[model samples]
Target: MMLEYLPLAVVAIVGVPLALAALTRRGDRALTRLALALFDGWVADRGRRQRERRELLYEVHLEDTYRMYASKTLLYAGLVALAGSVVGVYLAAGVLALFKISPETVRATLPQQLWFLADLLVFPDLSLGELFTLLAFSSATLGVAGGAITYWIRWENLSYRANARARQIDESIARTVAFFYALSRSGMAFPEIMRSLARNRSVYGETAEEVAVAVKSMDYAGLDMLSAIERLADRTPSQKFREFTDNLASVLQSGQSIPAYLDDQYERYREDAEAEQEAFLELLATLAEAYVSVFVVAPLLFITILVIMGLMAIGRTLPLLRVIAYFAVPLANVGFIIYLDSITESLRATREAREIDAAPGLLAGVRRTDDPDADRTGTERPAVEGSAVRSDGGERPAADSSAGLAFERLAAFERVRWLRDLLSNPARTLRENPVYVLYATVPLGVLSVVLRAWPHLVAGTLTVETLDDFVVQAALVVVGSFAVVQELHRRRIDAIEAAVPDFLDRLASVNEAGMSIVESLERVADTELGALDAEVERLRTDMAWGVEARTALYRLEDRIDAPVITRVTTLLGNAMHASSDLARVLRIAADEAQDTRRLKRKRRQEMVTYVVIIYLAFVVFLVIIGSLNSILIPSLPTGAAAPDTGGAISGGPLAGISEVDVEAYTLLFFHTALVQALFSGLVAGQMGETSVKNGAKHAAVMLAIAYAVFLLLP
Candidate 1:
C-alpha cells in the first residue's frame, strides 16, 4: 500500500523545499543564518581549518560561496536520494508483481519461525501491506544514504582541486619571488610590487592571485599592508606561500631591508626549486620504467599468452583475447597516461587565470605627465580621437593624427587582416588557432571520402569495409593536417625562444649604458638577432610613432605569443614604472628565461629515450600481431578433418581449430594494430613533449607505418 503512494511521497519530498523557500522569501537572511549555524555547529575545529584552507585556496567568500554551495549540495543530494527512493519502491512493487512474490506463501512455509521472530521483536504477524511498508522504508533509507555519500564525494573533489591549485602556486613561487625581488631592487615599494604582481596574474598564475588578495585587503578593506600579509599568511593553503608571507610580514615589522629579504627569499626558493626539479625528474624516470613494465611488457605478455591459448583452441580464447586487446590494454594505457599527466602537471607553468581581485580606484593616485599634446595629465586618450576639429569647427581626418590614425587604419585592417595573416604566416596563424586547420581539413577530407565512396553510395550498398576505408582516409587527412601545422608552429616557437635570452641580455646591456629603454630598443632593433630582429624593429616603430613604451612592448609580446616574452614584458613594463635603472631587472628576467630554456632542454633530452622506447614497443606489438595474422592463423587446420586431430607443431602441442573464424581474428588484429599505433604515437609525443598536441605528428607517423605494414606485409 505504501509502495502505491511512492510517487506522492517523492513529490512531497521535493515540494517541501520549494514551499519552505517561498514561505521564507522575506526571511532569507534568517534562514541562511540558521543553515550556517547548523553547519558551523556540526563542523569540528579541525574540519573548520580545512574548510578555511579550501575557501582561501579557491578564493571564495565564506558567506557567499562556501555556505551556499554546501547548502545547495546537501539539499540537492537529499532531493536526488528521495527521488531514488520513490523509484526504488516503485521498482520493488513492479518486480514483486512480475515475479508474483506472495507474502502469505512466504509466511505459510515458515509461519511459526517467522511469527516467533516477530513476537520476539514485539510485532504482530507479517502481512503483505506490512512487507510493502518495510520494503518502501528500506528503499527510502538507501536513497538517503546514497545522497549523503554523493555529497561527501563532491566535497572531497573540491578539496582535491584546492590541493592542485596549491601545488601550482607552490611551483611558481620562486619565479614570482624573483620578480618581486627585481622590482623591489628597482625601488618599488612592497605594496606596489604586490599590485604589479596582481596586475600580471595571467603571467604568474596562482601566486599572483594570492598576492592580489593582500592587495585587496590593503586597498579596499582598510588594512595596512603588514596586517593584510598576516591575514594572507594565516589563510593560504600552501605552507611555502604561508611561510613566505609570514617572513614578509616579519621583515615589514622589523624594518629589515625589503630588497635584501626579497633577494634572500628568491635565492632560497630557487635552490629549493632546483631540488624539486631533480626530485621530479627522478619520479619521471621511475614512471617511465613503470609505464614500460605495465603498459608495454605486460600487455605483450597477455597478448602472447592469449594467442597461444587460441592456437590450442582453449576455453573461449578469442573472446578473452578480444577483451585484452580491445579493453584491458587500452584502459591500462590510458590510466598510465593520466597518472603521468597528473604527476607532471606543474604549479610553475600553470595555465589558468584565477578570479581577479579588483579594488576600486586602484590607479587613482598615479599621475602621468609625459604627453605634451594631452589637455590634461593622467587621463587616457582613446586610441582614436575624433580626428581633429577644423578651423570652421567641423571634424576632419588628421594627416599626422599620431596613433589615432593608426587606430583608424587598424579598424579598417580588421576586416581582411585574417586573410593577410593566413597568406603571410599561415603556420603561425594555424598554431595560434589549431581549430582553423579543421575548417580546411574537414571539408577536404569529407570531399575526398565522398569522392572515394561515390560509387558505393550511388549503388546504395556500402559495406562496412567500404565505410572503414572512407573513415581511414578522412582520419588520415585530418590528423596529417594537424600534425604538419603543429610541427611547423612548434619549430617557429622554438626559434623565437632560442633568441629571447640574448634579446633580453643585449637590451639590458644597452639600457645599462645610460640609454632609455626606447633608445636601447632603437639601437638594438637594427642588430641581427635572427628570429627576433623583425620583432624588435616593430617595437621601435611603435614607440617612434607616439605609442606608449608599455603599449609598444605589450604589442611586441602579443605578436610573439610566448610565455617567456609575456613574463619579460610584464616585468619590464612594471619595473620601468618604478625606476629608470631597469638594467638589473632586465638581467634578472634574462636569467629566468635562460633557466626556463635549460629546463625545457633537459626535460626533452631525458624523455627522448622514453619516446624511443614507445616507438620500439609499438614496433614489437605490430610484429607479433602481424606474425599471428600471417603465419599462425593460416597454419591452423580448418574445416572437418576428423575433428582436426590435435597435433604437435613446432615443438608445441596444438589443438584443432574447428570453429575459429580466421577472417574475424585477422580483422581484429588489423584493427588492434591500428589502434595501438595511434595511441602509442600519442604517448610518445606526450612523453617527449609536455603537450599532447605535439603527439599529433607522432600519431600521423605511426598511423602511416601501421597502414603500410598491414597492407604490404600481410
Candidate 2:
C-alpha cells in the first residue's frame, strides 16, 4: 500500500539518513568530505544540466550550490519529507478511526486506512478507499513541489545577498588601492607600506581581507609582488580596483616616480570631486525650491482657500464645513509630508557626497609626504629666487649677502611715523573715512524704521497712533544700526585674529635668526603682507612718532578687541615695562591663539549635533501633531463640532465650549509660530556661524511650517 504512494515512501526512507548525515557531519571531517563529494557529483551535476537545458534561468553557481547543499540541504530536505510523512500517517489513522475498523484490520491495511482518512479530510462525503487513494497521490506530489519551491526562494535570496556583498567588497578594494597609492607617494617602501596597511586592515574594510591574501601569497607561498597583486585583483570583482592595480603594475614595470604620478592623480581626483560637488549643489538648490513649493506654498494656498470658504459661509455652512476642513486639510498634508521626506533624504545623500568629495584633500594634507632627507636636516634651504634680492642701485644681490640689506630696508620702512599716529586714534580714522560706516549702517536703519511704521500706516491710524509708531520706529532704527555696527566691528576683529598667528610665527622666525625683538617686528612690519604689514608699520610708527609702546598696543587692543590681540598687547606691554621674556611671551601668545581657534572649531562641531537634534525634534513635533489632527482627532466623535454663533452650542461633545471664545487659542498658535522662528534662527547661528540676519531664512521656514499646521487644524 505504501508502494502505491512511492514519492511519499521515498520521503520517509530518505528523511532519516539526511537527518543523521547532518548530525554526523558536525565536527566530523570525514562526514563533511563525504557529503561535499556527493553534492558535487550529484546535486551540482543536476543543476548544471538543468542550466544547460535552460530549464532554470537563474542558475546557482556550481561551487556555491555544492557548498549550500553539503552544509544544510540534506537536513532541510529530510525535515520536509518527515513532515509530509507524519501528515500522511495521521490522515490514514484518522480515516481508520472514522471507519470503526479494528486496529488488527488497519494493521494489515495501513495504506487503505490512510487513503480513507485522506479522502475524508479532502472530501468528507466521499467513499473511503477511492478518495484516500487519490488524495495520497496528490499529497505526495504537493509535498515534493512545496519543498522545491521553498528551497528555490531561499537560494535566490542567498544569491542576492551574496551579490550585494561582492559589490561592497569591490568598492572596498578600489578605495584601498587608492589609499596605498597615496601612501607609496609618502616615501613608504612598497613592502613596508603593505605591511603597515595589513596591520591596520580593519580600517580599510574588505580590502584588508584582500591584503591578508596578498601577504599570505608572498610570505607563505613565495609569490613575487606582481603575482601577489595580480592574484588579489583577480579575487576582487571590482572593475575600478582592477584598473588601479593594473595601472600600478604598469608604473612599477616602467620605473616611474610614484610620488609625482600620485600627485597628478590626486589633483585630477580633486578637480573632479569639486566639479561633482558644484553640480550637486546646483541640484540641491533646485530640490530646495521644489520642497518649498510643495510643502509651504501649496499647503498655504489650500488653507487660504479653506479659510475664504469658511468666511463666506460664516453664518450657515461653516459648522459642517469646518469639520470637513479638518479632515480634508490633514489628509492633503500627507502628500506634502511625503514630498518633504523624499527631499530630506535627497539632501542627506547630497551632503554625504560633499563629504566624500572633501575626504581625499583632507587625507592628502594629513598624510606623511616624501621628504625624509629634509626631515633629518631640521632646516630646508630656500629656493634661489626667494634668496635673491634687488639692491638700492637696482642690481640683484647675491643670495648670501642680501639678508642684512633686507633687514635694513625693513627697519627703515617700519619707522613710518604716520602709521603709529593712525593706530593710536581709530576714532579719528573712522571719522575721516566715514563713508564706509555710513554706507553699512544707513540702509539697515532706514529698512527697520519702514518695517516698524508700516503696520500703523496700513491700519490708517497714522495720526491716532503717532506716538506709538514713533517709539517703535525709533527703537527699530537704533537696534538695526547697533547690529550693523557690531557686525562691522566683528569683521575687523576677525581680520586681526586671522593675521596674528602668522605674524607671530614670522616674528619668532626672525628673532630666532638672531635679530632683536624690535628689529624682528620692524623687519616684518615693512613686508608687503597687507593687514599684518599695516599693523606692524603702525607699531613701528608709534615708536618712531614718540607714542609709548604700552599706549600704542592698548590703542590697538581697543580698536580690534579680539582675544588674541588683547593677549598679545598685554604681553608686549608687560614685557616693554617689566623687562620680561618677550620672545617666550610671544610664543605663548601664538600657541594660545592656535589653541583657541582649535577649540572654537571643536565647539562648533559639537553644537552641530544639538542643532540637528533641534531640527529633528521640530520635524517630529510636526509629524505627531499632523498625525493626531488628521487621523486620530477626526476619528473622534467631538471632531464633528459645529462652529459657534453668538451664544449657541450646536454639535458634538464640545458643544458647550464651542460657544466659548477660541481667540486665546488663535493667539497661542501665532505666538507658537513666532517661537518656532526664533529657535530656528538660533540653531542656524550656532551651527553655521552665520549672522542672525542670515538666520531669518531658516526662521521663515519654521514659521511657515507652524502657520501651515495652525491653518490646517480644525
Could you estimate the TM-score for every candidate? 0.77, 0.34
Expressed as tens digits, the lDDT of each residue in 363-429 for candidate 1 is 2222233334211134332335457777899876644455445445544765577799999998668
List where candidate 1 sits over 4 angstroms from the true fold: 1-70, 76-145, 294-409, 424-435, 640-657
The C-alpha RMSD of each candidate to the native structure, in angstroms, is: 9.2, 22.8
In model 1, which range of ten residues has the least summed lDDT?
A: 351-360
lDDT of 2 by residue, 1-714 (tens): 866567556666756555565477453444456556555454544566444322212121233334544344543544575566556655665655577555456545543324454433332345878767756765576567656765666456545544543444443442344445445533457765565455434334445555666777888999988788777665544454556667767777789887566555544544443454345345444543553454334544543454333333232333443443344434444443344343222111010000000012111111121333111111122224533455664655344335345434434654663477567885555433433444655676567667766887898766523533344344334433444444455556556667787787777778767776667767888766555566677777755555444555555554443556754554454344333235544554565456445544544464455445545555654564454345543442331454434333342223433232234324422443334344444334423332343243455456556656655666
Q: Which stretches of candidate 2 lie over 4 Å from their true place?
A: 1-34, 37-40, 43-124, 127-142, 149-162, 169-175, 260-714
Q: How many residue pairs clash in each candidate?
A: 1, 3
Best by TM-score: 1
- Model 2 deviation from native, Cα RMSD in Å: 22.8
Give the alpha-carbon lDDT of every model: 0.72, 0.49
